[model samples]
Target: MSESPSSSQQQPAVGADRPPALLVNNIEVIYDHVILVLKGVSLEVPEGGIVALLGANGAGKTTTLKAISNLLGAERGDVTKGSIEFSGERVDRMTPNDLVRRGVIQVMEGRHCFEHLTIEENLLTGSYTRSDGRAAILNDLDMVYGYFPQLKERRNAQAGYTSGGEQQMCVIGRALMSRPKMILLDEPSMGLAPQLVEGIFETVKRLNEEEGVSFLLAEQNTDMALKYAKYGYILENGRVVLDGAAAALRQNEDVKEFYLGISASGRKSYRDTKHYKRRKRWLA
Candidate 1:
């Protein structure tokens, strides 16, 4: 595999002055006790900042998120190396519930809402880890509605019947109900219309600005992810191949040619050249 660019060749991490909300330090993941999935991956999401984890499918983005949220156990995956920290506390070994209560939540990819539950009920489930009593949960429920007015309209409707955009809203609104300090968002734009995708990203920006909720967004939509994220890390085959501030990454020639489908010659097809040639160029 190609090595990531040296630190001197890249911009400093975004919000480096601020304390990090979540830190994954040189971690590795293995599934079924045999197959290695992540190779010494490391990144940081600063307090109240948005960072995008950009990669195509199977590039290990979701696995990285799962490792941070401590959700790998369900899939028989284990973090055999390195550690993860949240709010200055080591949380790699924490339970998923513990992580949620510690203000870390993951809205899993594919909008995993409870099909049998009403939209409102589905949202209420997010508050299950809170012990701050009913009043605060109800207050946050209303707060979620304020961010996603569409959910408020369909509060009584069954989640299974809701539109894909509405389901996406429901899941994110659900995460908000948990009052997270940092959210590991997986593919917020999947299966949505372009307009809806933009709308979702706009709401994410608003949440970051207004609520001060940091985000580690794992997404396949490189263009949209970079557009909204202040900084980004690009993963390939279980490793971070590139990382930088959003504007810098947008202008990087390697990024433009590969991820964004643009080159100095003009827009190009990723399949126009052999995969190894592309890898060799990145390695160079």
Candidate 2:
């Protein structure tokens, strides 16, 4: 198994030959000019690769995604340190709209579809930033529907009335409408049943393979994230405590015990007597 990188060391580039789709280097995020949310976080998504940002709630996953997408300003948060580059160009200074126009789009957590709009209408909004003409937009819309055939069935339904699973699909289809080269997907499995989660991930894999869209997925579902992602970084209180190839991370004793609820003996529980002690040792 491959060794995981320590918090202080940058992860070695995944696909060294291809330029990265996204690069975040030692970034710090400060909110309201006083609260430090992210501390020296860094990661990369190689072109056409899927990288998972795995962590428990409040581990700074969303903040990291916001930082990359330049959505921090709205929350009075700022990337106070380091640089973010897309396709080798500095983009931390760019506006979120500009970032979207440059082929980087973020599908935010909580499936933020417009309640009053039809599912198709919500998807069409993603193409608003494009000037590539109606024919291209319509073609892309067809492409999104192809990937999400259920959305096609409910194309005219109001987003407010859709099921959680269909709403999830709608949001992703909306992002697809932008024709993004790289997508920063935050918590794609939240608030869904297990079967739906599996379906969503399978579709994500298909999109990655067929559409060639690189993904930086932020998720609390570590097991599922590792199952689909090629590489992964585990965050603890805003810092990357561990990172490695997915298979290596799955095999890691620390990851198995703390994250996956498994150990050499058998399945483990957080209430185990040595839980905190084990956590301290892993973080150390």
Candidate 3:
């Protein structure tokens, strides 16, 4: 939040040597050609870097992801202004299927797997865009199982029957089958226990480190997200009000009190302190 030099210096600069994996520049999204959701939003995901998009409910995080993957059209939403570039190519005009071929895949917020299909079948659907042969696909499947042993154990079970956490892993594993250059992940910790959230984030960190995959993750779990991401952006009312390295964000007093729900004195129950509203510095 502060953008001080010390905070900015806490982490290594992202994408300093090469181009970013994805870049969204001054983009705006409108629904039904009337209501605007995103107001001149801009951000970047460095190649092979993990960046977190943090915000509360109705913050337009999902809309931003949908815009990147070109799924806005399904909801009568369109990017009326600005540009989105992936690997230096303009993708604002590309279809969702085309984006998949270009290695930009999105794991939606709800972990939308095929409810009627088995976990394995749902995972196999991710490779629909690939023509790389069965051997590669089989190898990737093995790799997915390696990352998620739980998913491997439940591979034969129907996806609709699996636990929420397992379904989360299944969607992410399915995304991996596409061999994505950048993944737009939304709210991965939605309905899981704290320990399960921690496990998922650890796996995400491992994937980023070992697979050289870049990620633009939108998460409501501020603490966990900042813990795993190298850099982060805080979205408020569809606008990026603050952005900095994860270390800096963690140390920021404003981020601690608001997003992390930590006060200067100590941690308190946010629900109990509903009347004690603190003004944001940016808004003030």
**Per-candidate local distance difference test:** 0.88, 0.89, 0.87
What does candidate 2's lDDT look like per residue over 186-229, in tens digits? 99999999999999999999999999999999998889999999
Task: List where candidate 1 sits over 4 angstroms from the true fold.
Answer: 1-12, 267-284
Candidate 1's TM-score: 0.91
Worst 10 residues of 3 by lDDT: 275-284
- For 165-265, candidate 3 gives per-residue lDDT tens digits of 99999999999999888889999999899999999899988998999888899999999999999899888777887788999999988788888877887
The better-scoring model by TM-score among 2 and 3 is 2
- Which window of ten consecutive residues has the lowest lDDT sum in model 2? 275-284
The estimated TM-scores of all candidates read 0.91, 0.91, 0.89
Q: Each model's RMSD to truth, in Å?
A: 3.7, 4.0, 5.0
Clashing pairs in 2: none
The TM-score, computed over Cα atoms with residue i paired to residue i, of candidate 3 is 0.89
Off by over 4 Å in 2: 1-11, 265-284
What does the lDDT read for residue 226 in candidate 1?
94
**Candidate 3: what lDDT?**
0.87
Stretches of candidate 3 exceeding 4 Å from the true structure: 1-15, 265-284
